[model samples]
Target: MIPSLRLLYWRPSAAALVRTRALLPMAEFYNHETGDGAFRLIQKSDYARALQGARVGLCLSDHEGPMRASVEYQLLDLPVVTTEAQGGRIEMMDPAHCRVVPADPRAVADAVQELAAEEIPAGAVRASVLSRLAAHRAALPGLIRPHLQAAFDDASAGVTLDDIGKVDLWRTRDAEVIRREVDAMPV
Candidate 1:
């Protein structure tokens, strides 16, 4: 697919938004029809469809595990611009095609533009990402080391597996704080 759009950034958070805004002049993504000029919120159902015209994948999350969207972008032959992230997403990237950047907005924006403009071969992107991802997949088990599973196992020694699964795995800090941060950015 031709990269008609400049950037694709799927995971959004308050800190992510601060950086995302710097690249807004170039990216094209859709969310919940926020009626804002800088963005349109995307739905999970149409994520792959939304990635079609994107020139580069912007992954700036501070998530502690492997990011799914960054892998998806590479598989689709799109170059990536990622931060010095907590997760091992960087390991899946070949520096020749994808960039490992700092959290700074200006730096991320510059790297995204550079990758977007380059005419790197699609096959090369996919090949490199695949090789790295394969190697990382093998190495991952050693690094994570039964982290959450071990905790759950210890906590539920006599409890059923099904019982352990039911829990408040996800929650937010404060809705108003998030809304305020989002409002701070220009539409």
Candidate 2:
């Protein structure tokens, strides 16, 4: 049997929908448009509360980019068990912060079990999330300017959300990103 990951997938395409429906018994299907997946899908109004209520935030995004959900999870201090494809942003998180693992079921299961058993300090986790969010927000304007200019100069080079694919939450030394961020801040 698979471990409880409390999957929170958004509206997927028809092809993806068919595949998931066939594989699993549709524990909960959500469509904010028609309010189709309310309890099963969950109410859009309560989406935030729902995310906060969960024990863990599971993101298997293969084409992820600066995942906001991941940050929210960190803010909530819920342990994460995501794929490496999500990338290095999570490197700052300690082993205790969350369990960044492979996307596979077995690996996810292991991470989930470990996090569930561990004692996580929600306050500290939330602080980390807030700090990271601020740093990322500050850097975003500069980092994205070039990409935007490139897109404007050449329509073919537009940086669409789809272009940012799955990332690896663990890349370089986690502390380095934070330290560099601190250094970059103007006194």
The global Cα lDDT (0 to 1) of model 1 is: 0.67
Q: In model 2, where do residues sit more than 4 Å from their true spots?
A: 1-5, 30-34, 37-45, 86-94, 137-187
TM-score of each: 0.55, 0.60
Q: What tens digits encode model 1's per-residue C-alpha lDDT throughout 82-144?
A: 888887688788888888888887788789889988989758888988888677666544433
Task: Predict model 2's lDDT versus the native.
Answer: 0.60
Q: Say which candidate scores most in TM-score.
A: 2
Candidate 2 per-residue lDDT, tens place, 1-187, comes to 3443245566677788678767766344434333654424544456666665567767666656667677667766777777776454565454556776766878887777777777776587777767766776565545645534544555424344334333321232377864785468653
Q: Residue pairs in steric clash, candidate 1? A: 30-40, 30-41, 30-42, 31-40, 31-41, 31-42, 32-41
Clashes of 1: 7
Please list the residue runs of candidate 1 whose C-alpha ends up more than 4 Å from where it truly belongs after superposition: 1-29, 34-45, 138-187
Error of 1 at 155 (Å): 27
Hey, what RMSD does candidate 1 come out at? 10.2
